[model samples]
Target: MTYIGRFAPSPSGPLHFGSLIAAFGSYFQAKSQQGQWLVRIEDLDPPREMPGASSLILNTLESYGLHWDGSVIYQSQRHQRYQEQIDSWLASGLAYYCQCTRKQIKQGGGFYLGTCRHKSQLTPEGCSVRLHVKQAIEQFTDQKHGVITIPHQLAQEDFIIKRRDGLFAYNLAVVLDDIDQGVTEVVRGADLIEPTGRQINLYRYLNQPEVSYIHLPLALDEHGNKLSKQNHAPAVDTHCAKETLIKVMLFLGFTLPDDFQSASIEQMIEWGCQHWSLQQLPNSLASSTL
Candidate 1:
């Protein structure tokens, strides 16, 4: 089978160290296997998206000599596609409208409690779509985290597929994107491990072929907060592009050569892709160095 991987990043901020590590790791992994690497803009979270951040991310990747196989797929432009999928799920009774609000759910221990599971009528407003979740799946090995399972309550809770405001949820977007892109391997930040089982359930429900998932240790701040836009992680310095690339390569488990330490961005990418190794990556978080 032809291997395919992706580096789907939410454009809430410029590509920071953490973001760079994910991009470089996935890009090189695909190249090492002589597979295709694609980029996708996970812009489903409208409120948090930063203006111009997506364009800047693409430009930054190019500066570091990490180009994708085809056109970058943006989620914003694919609303109609997501709606069609949701309608299909609804028609098959695989999903239903959820009317629970924040206040009610908090009292219900974070589980949806199936409050609206039997709502006879679908309201035009004040409802979210939820995938009827199932029982705990048996142990499945994460390429890095060893055997894994979603916490029982989380795994069994009927999770949201569309928010109350009618926007398509991340869970729906990710699974559909992978299926549409023919991505066989999903290499991404480990912070998303909790959601893997949920997405797996989505795939099974949709009758889509399962994809291999490898969650890399996240790059965290000293306080151990995952480096992200919400945490105020600084934007990457495109001026320090070459040096930044070296740090990310090292973080992804590549040893830099002393002679080529002063090499240009293209040379570093050439070397990085030639030496991608999944074994060198740690199962825990990689803290960012300033």
Candidate 2:
């Protein structure tokens, strides 16, 4: 099978260094294998999305020479696809409605007690849809991180697939789209490692082929917090694209040749693809300033 990979980013804010590193890692992983690379705008949450952020992200990727293989996919326009999966899950005995609030779950030791799993009468007014996780996905091997195991207690909880506000949950939408796009590998940051088991279970629940995963080390600030839009991480300077790419490469633990330091964006990417290997990547977060 042909290799396929993606860099799916939420439009909560502009593309920051953390996001750039993720895009860079995924891009190299796909291109190095002569595979198709796709970009997905995860614009499912309207309230968190900033106007024009999606366009800016696409432009930034292009400016940095991380071109996608086909038309960029917008999750907002694919509501029908997400809805169909949810409807199917509800019809089958795979998923059910959840009416428990955050406070209720917290009171029950912070994990869902599956309170509504047996309730037949559920009103859509304030109910969310949750996947009934019957089996525990204790462990799965990551291409880079090696044997990653979810705690048994956390693996058996019925997690939400759709929010009460009618927005498709990240875990649900991502799995469905990965299946729809025929993505063979998922390469992103280590911050999303915890969600991998849930997504894997969803793949099994839907009876689809589970994609391979490789999570790059996270870029953290001096304080040890991961750089994120929620923490107000500044957007990357695409005008200095080459310099930015160098930072990402160094963070990923590559020693560039002195001659290649002055290479253009396209040259850098080509060189990166030729020289990059997942085994060389560091497993721990490296501190850096924007």
Candidate 3:
């Protein structure tokens, strides 16, 4: 099968170094195999989205020479589709609405106690659908790291797929999109490692094909915090796209000379594909962001 991969970035803020790493890593993974690479704008949360951030992300990717194949898929435009999947889940009893508030769950600790699981008159008002946990262990391999298993206790927590305020949660939308896009493999930051099992459960619940996954170490500030918009991470310079690409290459465990440092993004991509190998990347690192 032809390889298909993507970089799904939220439009809450500008693309930072952390965002760039994920884009570049997924880009190289696909380009290395001469596969199709796609871009996805994860704009499901309307309130959190910055007004013009999506356009800026596309522009930045263009500047960085991380061109995507086909028109970019926007999550905001797929609300009806998300609703359809949710409705199906509800009808099939694979998912159900829970009316518990955050404070209620917090008093009992982080996990929801499934209080609403058996409530009869299930109403949508101020409620969200939580997936019924069934797995004892959610295990999968990291293409880079060896055998991995997220414990059942962590995986058993009832998780929300839709919000009480009526927005489809990231976990649900991402699973649907990944399956719909026919993603063959996923290479993203380690921050998302926890969500892997939840997404895998959804994929199985929906009976969709399983896609491979790889979670790279996160990029962090010197303070040991992951760089993010919340941390006020600076937006990357897409103007000197090649310079950023070179930096991303070095971060991903590639070696380059001063001469190649001056190369354009297209040239860098050519070189990257030629040299791409899992063995070249760092097996472990404190932090990673392009």
Best by lDDT: 2
Prediction RMSDs, each to the true structure = 1.7, 1.4, 1.6
The list of candidate 1 runs beyond 4 A from truth reads 285-290
The runs of at least 3 residues in candidate 2 whose Cα sits more than 4 Å from the true structure, single-residue gaps closed, are 284-290
- In angstroms, give how far residue 125 of model 1 lies from its true place: 1.3
What candidate 3 gets wrong by more than 4 Å, as runs, is 285-290
Q: Estimate the overall C-alpha local distance difference test score of candidate 1.
A: 0.83
Better of 2 and 3 by TM-score: 2
- Residue pairs with colliding backbones in model 2 are none
Q: How many clashes (backbone N, Cα, C below 3 Å) per candidate?
A: 0, 0, 2
lDDT of 3 by residue, 71-138 (tens): 89999899998899888878878779999999998888767877887775889998998888776336
Location of the lowest summed lDDT over 10 successive residues in candidate 1: 281-290
After TM-score superposition, the amount by which residue 43's alpha carbon in candidate 3 deviates from its true location, in angstroms, is 0.2
By TM-score, the best candidate is 2
Tally clashing residue pairs in candidate 2.
0
CA lDDT scores, all candidates in order: 0.83, 0.89, 0.85
TM-score of each: 0.94, 0.97, 0.95
Q: What would the per-residue lDDT of candidate 1 be over residues 167-196, giving only the tens digit for each residue?
A: 899989999999999999898877777788
**Ranking by lDDT, best first?**
2, 3, 1
